[model samples]
Target chain A: MPMPQVPFDDRGLAYGDGVFETVLLRAGVPVLWDYHYARLLLGCQRLNIPLPSREQLVATWQSPPNAELEILKLILTRGSGGRGYATPDNSQPRLLSRRTPFVVNADRWHEGVNIRICQLRLGHQPLLAGIKHLNRLENVLARQEWNDPAIAEGLLGDADGWLVEATSMNVFWQQAGALFTPPLSQCGVAGTLRAALLDHGVVQEAAIALTAIHQVDRLWVANSVQGVWPVNKLLSETGVVLQSWNPAGHDRLQVVGHELLGYSPTSR
Target chain B: MPMPQVPFDDRGLAYGDGVFETVLLRAGVPVLWDYHYARLLLGCQRLNIPLPSREQLVATWQSPPNAELEILKLILTRGSGGRGYATPDNSQPRLLSRRTPFVVNADRWHEGVNIRICQLRLGHQPLLAGIKHLNRLENVLARQEWNDPAIAEGLLGDADGWLVEATSMNVFWQQAGALFTPPLSQCGVAGTLRAALLDHGVVQEAAIALTAIHQVDRLWVANSVQGVWPVNKLLSETGVVLQSWNPAGHDRLQVVGHELLGYSPTSR
Candidate 1:
């Protein structure tokens, strides 16, 4: 497939004026298409962007695929516009879908990945919260906090010290046999898989704090492409080992994760 | 000049993982080129993007212009990269420069432009507060609040009710005899003209609340391209007029605005 090239004046580039979704593609079929599409539409409505028809999006995905296991990134931007931040009424919405080969460390699934608390705190913006918008510098900066291969993820908290999410994934923990994830009412991208878990009646959304990390029985981070990664050790910015957990319940969670994400960790 | 075409995978579109500078071009020369370049460089440094050399950027600007009075938009994105929020170490920064004809109403200067307080509050993110990075959904949303030609700009405040800036410009108000502009330490774009005003000691950076708007003797919205626009009347979201100014001190501020912005409202 040829790589797509957008006009330089695209509002997506100009102001990050768009929303996006990344779905796992298996055998050229996008996994959890309905959920991704629903969220994409919701985001468009929230931003007042004209929603692209579902048929238009489906037609875009029918193109030939280069990889069996791939990640399909769908970006819906407010197309091109003139100078200034105001949305042009005549501007059409653009659907840009790109396929990239999916790859993840199988070893990390067996041996839980280490995680760290990022120094950068997420800003509270209820309007933009929970929406997978293109304005993701916060996640990018949080991810850049460390370059260690062992540290698979960085946990991000909002300004008020409430844990929000990992840099690119939604975080959940099992405390005394009950599942809990941070409330994303103020900030963080509410991952599709995280919603699936909640819908499946396994995870409950609550206000989890940084201090609560020490009390968790088990911890895991989940995203669409990466599936779920259990956290073996959580570290503070000053290199303090805050919490360490054994991967006792990881296999059981992976089984549920496979059902929700439509991908098995062992296949990776 | 031709419109720039960036690769679809450009991080600017994918994550708004970039920074931009819109410089006013007069007779094919970019106005306040030094300040724009400096801000762009600072933004790049803050975002950890590789800084494009001054010569390279200058060479890009040497392209023959098609418009006499134009707005030159220069976007620097962490070029094309694979999936996820992580910045690719091998990613080369891409520079996109496009020229658009500049046009503004001269009547807006004479009969001061009406402004309104935006319903959308700027989120407080100290990491991204001042630097004009590409993650500007807040500004876009704020700008979309009104389409009335009578209302030239929307004043945005932070989540804490402290006034921040207008949708696309820095705001200044005179209380008694002192000029006060909201501090950008918590939110809002620390605009080029705003910095110049602070550097020239014409505007002092302080916390200005929305309640204090009624007490202001004079109000102005400023940017590099449009210079300064005096506010004749400020309105609430419900269309109720909050503060009406006499525009008595507009000329004085315009003189200082011209000195700092390198352009005059009358000239435009």
Candidate 2:
């Protein structure tokens, strides 16, 4: 299929003036549709962009190519506006969706993935924190920190050295059988899967420091697209192993992922 | 003219992964073309997007639009990419430009305009600071703080309460016959006009606090679109007058504007 073309005046392109969702499609069905949609609405409200009807989104997701496993990206922009930053009273919201083939490797999922810490520190802005807004240059720079395919992701922290999240996933650590994740009120995105884990009472949000990652018994990173992946090794920028863990807790997370995201380890 | 359409996969919409410039066109010619193009190139370099050739940009800006006074917005995005924050190896850059009619009121230029302080504070991101990139949600939110036409602009400060810039213009204050503007190294855009003023040795960049704004003898806001507007009164969020200045320095700034921006109050 051909890619969609966006207007030059799109406020999204002009000012990163929009929000987005990346949903995993399994067997032609979108997973965690409710959570994604709810987050989208919240983002719209935060930016004061008019919300599109729910039916419009559902219809777009329902009528799609029958791909077995794909990544469905939905971008909601404040349409087009004038040259300045002021929101026009007559401005309308726009929805753009596209699908791309994707496959999660079973080996990486089973034997956890390696991660490295990023040098780029995210600045604190509560007004823009926790929402999947389009102003993501920080994430882009963090993700570009490593070129080695062995490093699955890069961990990011706030300017004050508080552990936030991975480049695109939420970070969670298990210490004494209690799952703890960082509070994203100051920085970092609030992932849909992270919220689901919290709602299911499997994870607790707390203020975590970068140094605390070494004391954790187990670590995992998660997103809606890949569900969850255990962290086998965490490395610093100098390539020194900060921490390493066994995959003993992988099975428990697999069960939790199945219950929360309707994901199956064997599906891949 | 109608608005331009953008593609769904455009990186500018995806992650504000682009650079932009707003140039003022007088009698169908782009004002301060050299400075705007230089800044655009610098922004593209900072974001790692391939720079568009100068010939391509000049040709676009030089095209006759037949407008008396207009605002020409030029956006250059990293074309399309896969669904991720990482830049694609084979990504192509896209250029989009549109012209819209705009005119500065004579009263605003001659009698000075009222200004207000915004509640939304700008975050410090030295990596993305000073460059007029596509991530402008902060400015968008700040501009929406007040709809009162009497308030010509909103003054924004960094998270540390240091004055940065207005919602769209660079801020300058004259104290004891010396022009002082906020340093944009930590936050705020380094506007083209601001650079021009500095190059002329008429303005000095300093770390000025929000409270220091009241002590200044005179104030002015500047951008390429609108040459310069003197601030007659500065108001707090509760409509209380924070600082009021006479028009003593307005004529001096007008001469500076005429020399630097080729702007004449009588031309409009």
Candidate 3:
């Protein structure tokens, strides 16, 4: 909030050496604050980046509460100077938070959006599997696989043909009447909303193979900032529809998103 | 030299969505500039980030030429503004250059260093392999495996036990009088010096198994900054020497490094 202590040579910029959290704020209150805060803390701890007190993070916002939703980003870096990869014995962690306007299409909540499978497969690294660290070039590359405005998201899998998650959100699929999400032990960011859902027993972890993608009947993508969106279709690179799902069967799942994000079908 | 156009929310800072080059500058001239430039261009091209003109990059140095050697780091990032992973249509590239005094242990050039195998193994991602992108948490975690000043570098291998490289340098080993280094088509940074060596036909690529670590009588680690360091001994986690190499047989290999870096055994 104050002039960031992160210098030009900060490791975060140099080597992607940090963790970040994106919180959706509504009327100065963070939606799913407990889940987001817990993940932020876990990420910092996993990376050995000493975290500042909760008061320090909370104090970053000085603007008056806006009635509308806004995006708040928190970045905690290991700070500068360790001669390449070595952590400085006396390293001082840097904490930075920025608030920006939030924008979303309310229709997507009910109308759903089409998604695709990405060509780029995520490599396995259990040490960094679940933490939302800054090394997200894989996600960036997967997201860049398509620029078509109609295609809202892309599904990513590991090298072993196991589904991981969507480009910017955790993915859940329904075949019978239960919900299943990919396990993040091998790779992928452990989204806060996904964690909250698992904790509440709303979903179960399962390994979905690439060959079985079309077998599932219903699918949805979600994140803390975007809430939830039912995936209406899955398209191939050549624009052929590979799979489709009906929103009628998945409308009940949307209720969980509304309760978690404090959103309704009419709210943006 | 001008003020950085990168904002607090730049993609590079947010996701490490960029490439970097660390050049050893000797008397204002960049050592191995061509190889470094080529990799930089390849990285930007691979990520679809437009690169500026070569002359513009060269112009970032405003200080008078110094006779002493220094480290020059150039970072080029996909400039801000993209909906999560969707790149902005007219995204501008940001280039930043910083110079810091270079320091090295000259004795390591001749006396060599002791090394160890890292506990962490690199994940296979051919798409991002060997490009020197900023998603380098693997290297950071590998380097953190040890704090012993005696262990100059950590050797890294893939999940299948095939040797990849070291934390900060490309690795080379001599087997039966022929030089062999790991192929980085799956992962690891394809360093400028390593490319130069391969270009000059000074070395050949081979799949060195982790079990063959002790079988190779000679090993060396190299990069542009420190030139090269021979492995005098290989230590296990318990501080026991797993293998030892005689510098007398590998002094010829060090010559290749000295020639490429424009350094003499006597020079710093």
Write one digit per residue (lDDT tens) for candidate 3, span B1-268.
4324346667788889899999888877888999999999899888989987988788855476654788888888887764487777777877888777776677888688999998899999998999989888899888888998978999999988999999999999988889988999999999999999998888999998987788996999999889888899988767789988866543655787678888875432
Q: List runs of model 3 lying over 4 Å from the truth.
A: A1-6, A265-268, B1-6, B265-268
Q: How does each model score on TM-score?
A: 0.96, 0.95, 0.96
Q: Which 10 consecutive positions of candidate 1 chain A have the poorest summed lDDT? A: A259-268
Docking class of 1: high
Would you list the rank order by DockQ, best first?
1, 2, 3
Off by over 4 Å in 2: A249-251, A265-268, B1-3, B248-250, B265-268
Which residue pairs in candidate 3 have backbone atoms (N, alpha carbon, C) closer than 3 angstroms, thus clashing? none
What tens digits encode model 2's per-residue C-alpha lDDT throughout A84-160?
78888888888888887778666766778999999899998888898899999889878877889899998998988
DockQ for the candidates, in order? 0.86, 0.74, 0.60
Which residue pairs show backbone clashes in model 2? A5-B6, A5-B7, A6-B5, A6-B6, A6-B7, A7-B4, A7-B5, A7-B6, A8-B4, A8-B5
lDDT of 3: 0.84
User: Model 1 residue A98 lDDT?
Assistant: 78
Q: Candidate 2, residues B1-268: lDDT per residue as tens digits?
A: 5566677877888999888999888888888888898888888878888888878887765767766887888899888888888878888998888877787666777777899999999987898898999889999989989998888999999899999999999998888888888889877899998888888888888888897778888899878777778889999989999988776534565577655666664332
What DockQ was computed for model 3?
0.60
Q: Residue A91 of candidate 2: its Cα lDDT?
A: 85
Q: Show what share of the native A-B interface contacts model 1 retains.
A: 0.91
Which lDDT values do the candidates have, in the order given? 0.84, 0.83, 0.84
